[model samples]
Target: MAKAIGRGRGPTIIDVARVAGVSKMTVSRVINNEAGVRDGTRKAVLAAIRTLNYEPNIAARTLVTAGEARVGVVYSNPSAAFMSDFLIGVFEEAAAKGVRLTLVKGEDGLAPPEAELRRMAQGVDGVVLAPPLGELPAIRQVLSDAHLPTAVVAVGQPTGEGISVRIDDWQASHDMARHLLSLGHRRIGFIAGNPDQSSSALRLEGCRAAVDATPGAELIIAQGAFSYTSGLRAAEWLLDEACPPTAIFASNDDMAAAAVSVAHRRHLDVPRDLTVVGFDDTTVATTLWPPLTTIRQPVRQMAATALELLMGAIRNGAPAAGDHLLSHALVERQSTAPPNRARAPAPALS
Candidate 1:
């Protein structure tokens, strides 16, 4: 019922500046992530914003600055656990950087509508693509064609020209295979991911290299769609074979956990007649009673580094310097052991 001018419907930076006793420009600088704002000034502006619950008009600011303070994050992964964890990491960093993050949800996270993806970048300053399969062919065209900056996170290989954040997946997977081989597991089995995925190929390469390196280790292979039930189906097929592998490595925790279920149904004692392992230290690994052995991917670090790198490129128009690769560690748990001598040798399959 009062006038609309003084105590308006929404709070503004002018009110925040008035509360902080600073110029509107100073408030703008602090909100826009300018480097010149002193720590004291920044603190005061932030306090004023909090006190007033002031929200900036991002659309209006973009019109003035000619760009949006948003960084797009593109992710492609089937596991809900993986997606959620990675997003949490990304959002945490974005909040610290004062950049609004825009997510362009591609169809089922597949590479499509490169043009639309690029247009999605029209207002935003930069982007980060997560993982091997996340970088669809369309992604490259959009970023390259527009000369927009980008950072690829958790990618196995450097994109050759842009900033990237990742771990040595080959080394991590190779180490997991070694863990099984060290446990005196000779006849191991593999549940591979979809052939279309590059991570699937790299991960398998790691398994092959590890087994081939061992003096007397053997592996039988089966392919699946990277789903838990897919892992179950493949594990069921391999476990029923006359020569069941003593140990199995699923490309991810989802599948590896499935293998555990299959083993339990067959009344085979885990780590006795059968053993299982998974990559990516996801929550699924710990959901099992005995847990799983896997590689602890630096998910949070990767996401943060990607944000840092993308911010760098957005400000500089060129990719950031040096390597952004992180390291991985093997998380050993109760799911593996040497083959049980009492168990029947794999019977020859018909």
Candidate 2:
């Protein structure tokens, strides 16, 4: 029996062939969108692919017949969940296009050195930048000086920053704050993301806008590194304050989960004694005792789209100055709720 591809795993051509009840050659033709196959057979193959969520390794398929097309990716994110999603998107897209992807980890999310970047750009046609690497001027200068086409994901604004793709961090964070506000959370504590990433400022701006617009709501921010330890320290600081806020919002899931842990240590009931929310709906969001309410950034889809755009730029041999804005959603779970009156004070009148 052929083992089916599990969720988050790539489906093979043979697997598609079995589901479509067609030969492997027919499945290949369908994937290549080539003519000569009967309409009925083509439809069956496509339907099977859709049902299985199949993503073909296009690079492998085309390597024998066409010249190699390679794209390099530089990333430096501390969260394993975030990195996993981001790479999956890029690789899936690369496979679909039959383009080879080479990944290089940046030191602290910044490209290594000019010589290293020059070497990396030698055979690579283009590059994909992941924040905060994408936000670094030095990295951009290195790639730009090397004449390498590039795309960036999760950047704050378009800025014509080398074929950028991102969701509106400011809007998403604003909506998150609005959800908490609607739930009667007035004095909200925010843990800022790494200052090196542009998304951090944008998220802070969005949260601040929502808080400022609401009557009698107060916003207190703590510096964070977008890491679990940072979240723990920040949460501890907030909880230790004489007048700690009724609700806490961490910039990312790692920090948010850490904040939950801190609350547990303090003997606070989640969403009861203290409400907590996180940014990315990564794996950690649901692993907590009470699942986290968070903003879903669509990291995987964004990564995929960035690769697609980067491939185009590589083909054209010139960087494209364009912005591909993807969508974001606020995922509600058990982690957030109205303020606990006994544990915290009510909203102050302006």
Candidate 3:
């Protein structure tokens, strides 16, 4: 008698073959999307697979005899709501690939990183990192030391500075600036993100390039710590400047929301009186009174592709290297416009 594979333990190819009255080779072909199997046989095999809740082992050899394979995702956040989308993106892809996402959240609080990494590394076949937080050299080194296939989904730049999956942040910001400039705005305010992150530095560089490209346009730059409070302070400084910018661009949605708040308190109408824009199309973009026009980060698609890349690496029977850059789109919401009704340029003091 064949030993039963317990529920939630994952069904093997042999289990599918036995239940469907077919050979293991046929099951393999069907799972890989190969076209040789008979349609009727394929349906039977699929039905049996569904009956047993069968999920093919995406890690290949690691599935059969060894312990359960884990895919570690190192994220940085103080709370879950901060990364609700990230967690959803990661786990949904993991489930489709029949791999588990072993999450490790690190920042100021939570568990000791080294100890946590060690614990999370247990039975892990690959690693996925979500950053500005995860793009650290030390973090990649830890994954390298484990010799696991790894992918980094960056929050900032798409330099692939390290092994990562990112969109071109510099180009994205540059495009954002150009959009505002096309609307006939001359003086533009730019708020940067965390200083330590490569992404933040890259975005600032993009803004500078845009300013350099637009003749007669002045760049009003302020550094923010990538938080709502930091965003408010930075926007306040820019707004306080004499002959303040007509348009404001924030590096992320959180800061952008803060900027809108400042504009509101000053009784400035968005788009008509002052144009505001933000990066990363988070829920906050739509939730704001005037929905933000921002860059759409392909987070969920990146997450899915990361899983596919990791699985491919695992099947190759070696550790993974390098990075992947996904495409990004501009989601134009209601937050941005030309400073058309510009009134006496609004006293910078206000």
CA lDDT of every candidate: 0.73, 0.80, 0.72
Candidate 3 residue lDDT tens string, 97-127: 6776677877742333786786665446577
| Residue 61 miss distance in model 3 (angstroms) | 8.4
Tens digits of lDDT, candidate 1, 1-350:
11122654687654564566544445566677777566776888788888877788874344325433567787776677777778888899888877788887654447646776766655455677876444465677766554456677766556575677777767788898888888888888999986766667778889889999888788899987677878989998888777778899998888998888888777777767788888888888898857888888878778888887777554432334345768888998998888786794343234
Better of 1 and 2 by lDDT: 2
In the range 14-36, model 2's lDDT, one tens digit per residue, is: 56755665444445556666556
lDDT, model 2: 0.80
Worst 10 residues of 3 by lDDT: 59-68
C-alpha RMSD of each candidate structure in angstroms: 10.4, 13.6, 10.0
Model 2, residue 121: displacement in angstroms? 0.9
The TM-scores, one per candidate, come to 0.76, 0.78, 0.76
Q: Number of clashes in model 3? A: 2
Candidate 3 or 1, higher lDDT: 1
- Which of the two, 1 or 2, has more TM-score? 2
Query: In candidate 2, what residue range of length 10 has the lowest lDDT sum?
Result: 312-321
